[model samples]
Target: MHQTSSRLLRMTDDERPFTRSYIWPQYALLFAYPHRTSLFISDPNNSCDFKDLFSTLMVSLPLTPHRVRFRMIDFTFTSDEAITNLGSLKFSQSNRMPDPKDSSRVVTTTTTTTFSMAKEMARSVCQKFFEAKFIESVESKIDFQNKNSVWQLTPKGIHILERFCSRNGIQSAHVKAVIDSSRNPRQLVILERDIDTDKLHHDEQTVEIIFRRFVGATVNESLSADSDSIHEFSRSDVGVRMIKHKPSNARPYEHVFTGKATVDWLMDCCTMVDRREGLEIGQLFLDLRLITPVDARAPGNDTKFVPTKQAQYYVTVHGQQIAGWTEFDDSPIPADPNSGKSREGAARDSNSNRTNVIIRNPSWRLLYREFLKDTMCEENLSFYLEVQEFRAQYTAAVSITGDHKIETIRETLAAAYGLYNAFLAPGSPNELNIDHALRTQLATRMTRAVGDDTAMMQSLVEVALLFEKAQNSIFKLMSSDSVPKFIKHPKYGPQLRGLDAAAAAAYVANSNMSSSRSS
Candidate 1:
């Protein structure tokens, strides 16, 4: 809590001589009427938990201290007017109201009571502000026109309110509500400390950052820890040790985390944040009520503090450990394209020219060309062109290695059928116009562009052979005498009539089986 000065303002002539009757009327009228600022206060204690809204304000607020002041005016309505207004207003507690039929009793007492009630309410607000240490002091002055005492924020109070308003991106009206203790904190606490970058260490105290962008849309609740608990994608080699914690509070840690080896491996994928830093981040989140302790009976249940795919997060430690973000934007550093690869003079064995040619060819472009006359269609052609361009761009940019190369070749094979299907479509294009010679040309260019990777080369050759076999089977079936029946019949209709129903089925089955085995 921040320390504040205790300089009290002396009451003015009109403000003095306060009594229970004067306070009750004011309190009742204020309570009975609704104010926009009051909506921000969910609890009477002036403590709040506004959820994500509060977090947003904390992040966007300016750190530099500043000051702002506003003069509070007396209630627009007179005591009698407030009492009269209260007749039509609702009260939470019916007992707070007096009999309306007794006009004499109401006139003599209710006017002071209404004003007094409002005064008490203001005093309560002042008390809340003092408790929260939100103000240095409050002052009062007589309004020259009305001789009514008005409250105002002292310099310290103004500075604090201004800072809060700036950080929260709220207007002066909202700031006034906060100063009056009409608004509470949305969360348990808002941590404004600057994260220390010196605490960062790699390897032992760090984890390799791994970022994944999902292909489709995702929701906050669906990506939450409760939906799918965080765990390592792979196991670690490090030996296990007993976790140091008491039994009653240990189940959550035990259930959420895995073995030491696996934990290390999982952490390796996260950006490095040491244990001490992790503790600080965790404490901040805990104080803000972002995360609560896991229940003993139902572990890994709903979590407010856990970072879902929806929330930005820094690398964490242990189970649900929070830590500093890698960058100001909170984005993870991308994995280097050259990571783990031999750079400059590092020795790497060379493959034969023959294998090199196959890699460059990938031969999938050849396969696409071969099947183009049989399958080209708008959708197929569009996708085929996109994949082709992507592969070309990727090959030209980097030295092919590991999964990157393998994935490219895999994509080639995956979309290879589109060309075949397009060529065989109802309004098929001319087969003669499509060049067959480009197969070798495409393979050569691709191989040169992709450079060399053993796994990628092998995958390319394998898929090429399969594509070749497919084209051959397709051509053979199209040219055979059985083709006339295939052409005469509807797409899904009968063919190979020499054999009866059973024989035809058996023959077709055998052909498919042979084709599958060959591929």
Candidate 2:
């Protein structure tokens, strides 16, 4: 390769300019450090001649091993009129006095200038280069209204190059900070994005989550009390609508009624949909009471049935199975027993299919329990049963839709249970077992119920204190290993306390306590 500058001449081992015959896999370095924030642009004051800019870029390339190869090159040139109107690029000049050893005595001066280009136009140029392989494929784009074109590198390209460079020990200090920052994981906050359309219905269900954000440290106050005195809260702030993507929400909710098989198979059995596997699941929700067709079946009415709202769940056989529908006439449809079609044409009417069974606010306890049951085994049998019972009682006591303090307590308890079982449990699974719908619902509900950070923290602290008290009380009786064993033994008990120490020792010896303990 011919070098026009000394910088280009100092290329390390396999580093070379873009060439048709260059072996990309064999080379362990890239042209620039690829990042989302940084972009390459030409000097605004310079002429738009592509050849001159390209040459300058090669010569000015920082002495650093790049983690990502150049994806595309952008050449942006402002019109003469625009340049004249915007004025010459902003610049600064520095003067250097001539030294005594210099014979020519010419004062050296240097200029630094900031360039401006139309970013959209630059992106277009980069796109063309990417398509032609003049550079690599297009990774991403940055939208800017100002006059500047930027060509950014792709993350995959950067990662591949980084791994290659690491293997070769070609570390570059210039890109070290960028690499480290990119490697660090980001803090996650629970949020929901609202959408007006059911565009993603095929992929997953969209569930609404309700939560409140506070402006200050009154989170505890907000959570403990009502949010009536608004701090500029909006309907948007109250809740966010999020789509529950598949498999994440598609984990089979196990039920004894669904037989020993998964809820997926049970759904298949119930629905005639083309993709029957997970199709019916969207229509089937957890009913805590294990309400059957007989339980819900009306005495004289054959077509319409409305059981007690307590512990109820609604799953639609058609459309998205969420709430928000016009109230249906609870009375049975007047139908001919022979034909089974309604005389009022209600069966044919689209409105007749609407039912009240779909609950807008499902029991949080049941929803979480059914979801978590997928990960449990015999070891957590007691916990599983406790969750099942807790859900049943919770649904029976609380209305489906309301902002009662009791509801907030239920949400907090559910979150606490999830944290303990899925996160803090011994031999717990590493990944979060929660589905998108449940997460969105629970997060919003808890946020709304608690009020703010301080309120939520206070609620959690109270729960923790209660749990600690309960644990101390329960363990007091069985805290020592020897006490419970002695109480249970038929030969020793409270009655033995009245006997002398000699008699107790004799009894212990006769019962073969040492042998029993060893066994």
Candidate 3:
């Protein structure tokens, strides 16, 4: 089912069914039909208007099998005959009868103005449908004025329309029959279900707790006589063993546990029911970058945690810090008297000059965030991280190519709204200092109702771009204004310098130990 939906959504321009020239005539005819007595003016920019127009088209336009030809080949396609009669309709005053009392003149004038406006409005709506891949040209012609080219609903179009009818309780038996016959047989068993947002949130929290507990439970230890080797042993008697892993490229030795042991720990301690569930939770940890494979370049590399003894992984430094495990080697480095700077001062100077380096390292980022908090400008860093997370989700949402694409997009939009309310909205608790014009643009786009999949996707894209701009603004503000102050702070600066010196000392000690082991 997802395969089919993904293929339809990814249709290329050359594979598209409709030509640019065919859309206006068909929609103009539908809009200008004299029998459309109930037609009313609506805002072209509003999503509700688009929905109403689509519903009206579905009801008013004739749907039947029509003979079409492309590349000297005949095909039976479903479409309406509105395009055939587009030339017969006229929106000018000449089409109306003369009225001496001027009462008839008023009616003619109104009809002429309304019909012309409606035609253009319909054309605009039709273009949106084409852009959304809901309609395609029957003849696939290139000419802008090709009246011979009719429009037909693509499979994706048919699916969305069916959903629209079902959602609104609008029954069209013929349309249902067409959908049933056209739908892929394999997708019949896959019923569409509403996403359980609360469950998703709960699961995320649960996984976070599990990850923290797992990292806390596993502590660095010396499991062998070799001083260069280190292993992380579980605090509990689960007997999980993490062996020392040293890469062939002379990377430092790190503790790594087999995937099977990790899954076992998740099931035995984390209350996971089965191996499948344990493996899934483990994979979630991998996705969050809490853990990584020791042999990433191995054959058949997968991001997912494979529940096998052959697969070895290690907890990341960021994961360890977040889990409340501060295992920094506090060994002191001797001062260089000849350099005219103390060891601590040299470390501070090196780190203070590199704001990018500070943010990239989890330890430095934590300290920097603390420094910002003391300065009463922590919101800048908070907003920056929030936008970073939103950007990741936006990327994932747009790249989705499955039946759940709509659901993923909806979730991303919800996150975007939350982000705006928290940081971008006026008078928001963490209101960010951003350009007023950009803020207004976001407000306008977010305030509008999203009526359909097309509107929702479009709004999501627009919001993502605006959020990116706001993120960039905040990042620049922090880099130019706050970062320098943080690096030179009287208290946090020394602490950061200490951390850098400890890390350097630890690296040198590890290198010495490795050399002695080799000897």
Candidate 4:
């Protein structure tokens, strides 16, 4: 068992269970409670009555080399208040007493506990906490008592507290500030020391230079013929398009480029060696909001930048304005009279061009799957879809209530293990190309047998978290590596263009018919 788990299991049988599900809610409540700071007492070893400790002030003072002193009263009071306010334990009077004036009437009043009883209960709870290694005294005392010595949360306690706050969505700024200020700075030094300062600076400079060069490059309208050949679109021809705003019923044009065009420019001009590197750079640009998907109705809506010929993006207006680049003229483009194409025909062409069949249309998924099969990387897509299905199942199982909850969780666990064996386990056929550390962690979790409901739920949560990380890694692999090759494939590229052409012809025919009838 992990050290934390072993510590949690150390509680006495008479004490309340120290399981995660049981303790986290209580921890959150106590951590979030407000406590008054007390002035430093002159006598450090002052003793007090157990009941009086609840009302005693808490001191925040540096007692040791790097450790800070926190009063026991603050923790006791917070624990008392948290336990008293709990819905299950709230003080209530079940028995009614006869009224003084009228024997026929009865009065109902809330039951109040004696100070001694409340004090004892809080002390017992705090003692359990100390025994479980949640908190320790600055003086290194083994037992918890009502003394002047200060106390602080142990690493285990902080870990649980952090997890509880995250799980419960408790965004208490005051709580965070307190935790941050109280935490030992030595723990963070190792993480800070691992960062390569010079390399990080170089990366930042390179990204900034790339962004400047990319935005300043000339852009133009995409032609119908350019869709057939990825290389046919000139650097200057990869420009802006006037797309109609469906909600506002207004035409707005923005400087845009196809994903293929962007990658090509990065590889050819920016010295990017391979398609994956170029796609990663493009994704970085999308993440920073320097460029945005044209299909997205608003900025910051989409994070995944598809590196395909069909995918389009715009240089964000804010970014362009900041860089002092001139905006595209808002005026409508004059129709090409020589081509003999009507306004309706042009609209149909734009509609057909906007189709991203691979993602939007279910029918095209099979075609993409077949293409992946030919490339021997069909496992990537299969794993992605399986993880998505497992996520849906896990979500539904979590919503289950009552007696069926345990059984539902068991079923979810089965599904989780099935996913793990198929894609993540070592020596398993079709094992995924995930990080070695993640696979090893999954292996460790999967090998352990869960005995009880608490253990089962804990295992399930850990597995789900690890699976999510693996899913993300696989998704990036497919997006940056496989998807680009699939898009540029000779067989698939022509088929995609053919579908677009056929759709365009059908749209123009219907549009002309509609126009004739309206006239």
For residues 108-139, what per-residue lDDT tens digits would candidate 4 score against the true structure? Answer: 32222122225555456556455444456555
Better of 3 and 4 by lDDT: 3
Give me the runs in candidate 4 sitting further than 4 Å from their true place: 1-360, 497-519
Which residue segments of model 2 deviate by more than 4 Å? 1-125, 128-158, 167-169, 183-519
Off by over 4 Å in 1: 1-118, 127-321, 324-332, 335-519
Per-residue lDDT for 1-519 in model 3, tens only?
A: 000000001112233222110001111111112233222323121112233334335434545556554343122232223322221222211111122234234112122212222344345445555544345566663222443456665544454555444323345565555556543121100111112110112234345545655654455333531221111221222234566666555454367777877765554332222245556778888887777877788664457677777787777776665454555455566664543333344454443335555554554665576567557776787677667767877898899898979766765675575467556655455578899899878766655556668987888898888988998888777767887777678755654554544444444454568789999
In TM-score terms, candidate 2 sits at 0.16
Give candidate 3's TM-score.
0.32
Ranking by TM-score: 3, 4, 2, 1
State the local distance difference test value for candidate 2: 0.26
What is the Cα-based lDDT of residue 288 in candidate 4? 70
Which 10 consecutive positions of candidate 2 have the poorest summed lDDT? 21-30
**C-alpha lDDT values of all predictions:** 0.27, 0.26, 0.49, 0.46
Backbone clash count, each prediction separately: 33, 17, 3, 1
lDDT per residue (tens digit) for residues 1-519 in model 2: 000101111111222111111111110001111111222222121112221222222222232222324533332122222223222222222323222234245333232322344544434433332322122212233322223333322222233233323322234454343334442111111111111110112212211110111111111111212111111111111211111222224332211111111121221121111122222322322221111222234472222222222211222222111222223334643433533222233333211111111111122211222222333321122222333333443344343445445444434344343333232222233222334444433333322334443455465555444334333332332223222343344532322221222233333343466579889
lDDT of 4: 0.46
RMSD, one per candidate, in order: 32.3, 30.2, 22.5, 25.5
Query: Which tens-of-lDDT digit does each residue in 276-314 have in candidate 1?
Result: 333344334334432344442344333323333233222
Candidate with better lDDT, 1 vs 2: 1
On TM-score, the leading prediction is: 3
